[model samples]
Target: MTSFEFPGQYYELMRRDFRNLAAETDFLASLLPDGGRALDLGCGTGTNLRELGARGYCGVGVDQSASFVEYARRMGGEGVEYVHERVEDFESEDRFDLVYCLFMTLNYLPRAELRRVLRKMRGLLLPGGHVVLEFGHLLNFVESYQPYTVAHHRGDGVLVTRLARQSLNPRAANWRNEETLLVREADGRVSMYDNFFDQAVLTGPEVRELLADAGLHVSAEYGGFRKEQVPPHGRGPVVIVATAEGAGAL
Candidate 1:
C-alpha cells in the first residue's frame, strides 16, 4: 500500500491541526436525518469522523497510514472508530447512510482501482444513501495546476512552511507530488522533512463513467463551497454527490 510513514509525526501534526473540512461535514450533516451512520474514506486524522460524531452521527474512519489511524483513535476516543487499512481492503457488515470519499483521496488510486473501490463503497451503502466525492477536475488542472506551491501555517509559537513540487503525467493520468516541510520553533530551532506520493488524474467524463459503471450516478456536482454548479471548464475542486444504484426507484 502507499505509505507516508516518513518524517514521523510531521505529517500528522500538519494535518491533525487542520479543521477546515468541518464545513464539508456540516454540508453533509444537512443532508441526513438523525441516526445517520457515516463512513469516511481516506479520513486523515479523523477530523471529519469526530465532527460527524459530534453532530450525532455514528462514524467510522479509514486511512492507509498507520500513524494517522493511531492519532485518530487517540483523538476521537469511542466516538469514532478508525481503521488502519486501505479503503479497498476495509469492509463491514453495517451499511451506512452516507459514504465520503473527499479531498481527492480517490485520485490516489489508479483508474481500475478507483472503480473497484467505488463498487465496494456502493455495497456499503443503504438504499437511498449518498456518496460524496471531492477531487480535482479537468479544469482544475488547466486553470489552477501549478508545479510548485508554498505556504506557511501558524501554530502555538511555531511556524510551519510547506513546499510542494508536482509533475504531471498526462499519458498515465497520474502525477507525483513531492512535499517538503520546514518547521521553525520559537526558540530558533528548525527541522525539515519531506515525502512524496503519486495520484491518478481524471477528467469529468472519466469519473462519471466510473461511477455509472459501479452502479452509482452523480446527483449533484459543484465547483465550490456554496453549491456552485460545475462549469464546462471551471476551477476549484469538483464536488460530486452520488447515490447508490436504484436509489430513486425506491
Candidate 2:
C-alpha cells in the first residue's frame, strides 16, 4: 500500500464523485438567512463554505484535520475562512444565522459527544437561526450494503479511484465504512491511501429526541436531498432541520 502523510489532502478529488455539492448547497441556501454569518461544523476541505461564500454568505469552516484545513485555506475565497479545531472544542464569539454539520459528520461521534456538539451548535447560533444535520440511517446501511463499490474521477490531469465497503454491527449499533483510494498524478506517480470510519446507527425518533434534548426543535425532516418528508425508518439519508426552542418557523 502506498502511504500518505495526510490522506485528507486528496479529499476533494473524490468528494464530488460521491456527492453533488452544487445541489446540496442549493438546498442549504434556501434554508439560510439572507446574507448572514454561517458556520460549518466538521467542514471537510471547505467545499461547502466556498459554495456558500459564492452565494454572498460569509462563512467559517471548522475541522479537526490539519491537512484538510490547509487545503481549504489554499483554495481561499472572499468571505470564507477555515479553522483547524475539533468540533467539540471549537469556540467563537460570533453568532451565526446558520450552523450546519453535513455528510454524516455527527454520526461519527458517540451519543454523549454528539449531544455536546449539538448543544454547542445551538449556542453558537442566533435566535431563530437554523441547524442542519445529515445523518446516516441504519436502514440506509442495510439497504445499500454491498461487498464493495468503486468510484472514479479525473480532473486537472489527476485521476483518482476509490473502493468503498460498509458493514453494520447490530449489537454495537454502529456502521463501519472502509475506503481505499488509488491516485495517479500528472507526473505518472501512483499512490494509495486507506481510511475507515464508524458511525452510530440512529433512527429518526432517536435523532429527534437528541435534538430536543439539546434545546433544538425540529421543523423539518427529509430522507435525502429532496425536500419531501421521509418515513420514520427511511432507508437513506436522515436530514434534520431545526431551530432553537421558541424560534418559530422561518
Candidate 3:
C-alpha cells in the first residue's frame, strides 16, 4: 500500500471543502481532559493541532510531508508542535492523554504494520487515555462505488479540481484509490498532481477486533464526529473511540 503526499499549497484549500476545522476541533476537544496532551498521527498541515492549542491543549502533529510540516510551522501558535516524519517512525518519550488518527490514515498502512502502529500508539497513551480512529465505512464503499469529482473556486482567483476514483481489488483484499488534481493559479498557470494508493477495507467489527488485539477497548462507535449512531447502511465515516486497558480514573 502506498501513501498520499498532498500538495502543501493546495491542501488547506482542498480540505476546506470537506472538513469544518473549527467544528471538528471542538468535537475532538470534547473528548480530551482539562489541559490534556494530544498526539495526531498523519496530521496534515497541523490545522487541528493549531485549533486545539488555542484551547490550552498541548498538541504534537506528525506527518510525512515536509512541505506540510513547514507550512504548519509557519502558521504556528502556542502549545502546538509539528514534526516531519512518517507515522511508522515517529516516537515520543512523553505520553499523551489522547492519540488520534483521522481521515482513514491507518488504511494506508500494511495490515501487519498497522497492528504494530496500533500497539505503539497504545504504548504512548497515559492511563485512562483514549485513541480515536476514523475509517471509511464499508457500506458506503460497497453500495456507492463510483468515481467523483470535487471542484473549488476561491476568491483569490485560484480554481482547483480533483478527480477521484477507487475500486475494489478482490484478489488483493483492498481498494485502489487514484486522484488527479488540477489547479489554476491567478496568473493563468495550471499545474496537475496525481496520487494513487491502496487501502484496506475496514468495518466496525474488524476495527473492534484490531483495537482489542492492541489492548484497547472500544468505548463508542459513531457514524460521524457529531456522535451520530451508525445505521446498517449509513453513508458516514466510521469513527471509533477506544480506551486503554486497565485505565485509571481520569
Candidate 4:
C-alpha cells in the first residue's frame, strides 16, 4: 500500500481541514480524567493535540509527515510535543491515558501493516486506557459504488481538483483505488499528481475479531463524532471505542 503523505501537500490540506476541532477535543476529554495524558497516532498538523493542551491535557503526537509535525510544533501551546515518525516504528516507554487513531488513517495501511500499527498502539496504552479508530462507515460497503470527484477554487485564485475511483480487490480483501489531483495557480503554474493504493477493509463481525486479535476489545461503537449508536440499517463511518483487552476500569 502507498499514500500521498508528502508533507508539502499538507499545506493545501490545512487550508480546508474542516474537522470540528472543539467537539473532537470535548469527546476525548469526556473519556478521561482531569489532566490526562494522551497520544494521537497519525496526528496531522497536531491541531488536535494543540486543542488538548488548551483543555489542560498533555499530549504526544506522532505522524510520518515532517511538514505536519513542524506545522503542529509551530502552532502548539504548552504541554504538546510532536514526533515525526511512522506510527508502527514509534517506541516510547511512556504510556497514555487515552490513545487514539482516527480519520480512516489506518485505511491507508495494508492489513499486515495495520496489525503492526495496532500492536504498537496497544503497547503505548496505559492500563485501562481507551483507543479510538475510525472504521469506514458501513455505508461504504452498502452504498452503490459511484465515481468520486471534486474541485475547489479558493479565493486566493488557487484551483484544486480531485478525481478518483474505488473498487474492491477480492483476492486481497481490500479496497484498491486510484486518485488524481491537480493544483492550478492563477500565475499559470500547474502541478499534477496521481496515486494508487490499497486499504484494508474491516466489516461487521470480522472487525471485532481483528481488534480482539490485537489485544483490544470494543467498548463501544458509534456512527460518527456525534457518538450515535451504530444501527444495522445505518449508513455512516464506524467510529469504534476500544480498550486494552484484559484491562479493567476507564
* Candidate of highest TM-score: 3
Model 1 TM-score relative to the real fold:
0.88
TM-scores for candidates 1 onward, in order: 0.88, 0.89, 0.91, 0.82
Whole-model Cα lDDT of every candidate shown, in order: 0.77, 0.81, 0.82, 0.74
Q: Which ten residues in a row have the lowest lDDT in candidate 2?
A: 1-10
lDDT by residue (tens digit), candidate 4, 1-250: 6555433433435345546566677788887778889999878777777778888999899887776677778786779999988777789989898988876677765667776777778888877889888766345754845556454535367666667787887677677668776777779788877766666766757667778878998888887777877767866677788898776533
> Which residue ranges in model 3 land beyond 4 Å of their true spot?
147-155, 248-250
Candidates 1 and 3 compared: the better one by lDDT is 3
Model 1 residue 165 distance off true place after TM-score fit, in angstroms: 1.7
Q: RMSD, each candidate, Å?
A: 2.7, 2.9, 2.2, 3.1
What TM-score does prediction 4 earn?
A: 0.82
Q: How do all the candidates rank in terms of lDDT, highest first?
A: 3, 2, 1, 4
Query: How many steric clashes between backbone atoms does each model show?
Result: 0, 0, 0, 2
Off by over 4 Å in 2: 1-9, 165-167, 231-233
lDDT string for model 1 (57-148, tens) is: 88888888777787777776445798888887888898888898887788876666888888988888887888888887666666756899
Candidate 3 pairs with clashing backbones = none
Candidate 4: where are CA atoms >4 Å away?
Answer: 6-18, 141-144, 153-159, 184-191, 195-197, 246-250
* Cα displacement (Å) at residue 169, model 4: 2.1
Cα misplacement distance, residue 147 of candidate 2 (Å): 4.0
- On a 0 to 1 TM-score scale, where does candidate 2 land against the true structure? 0.89
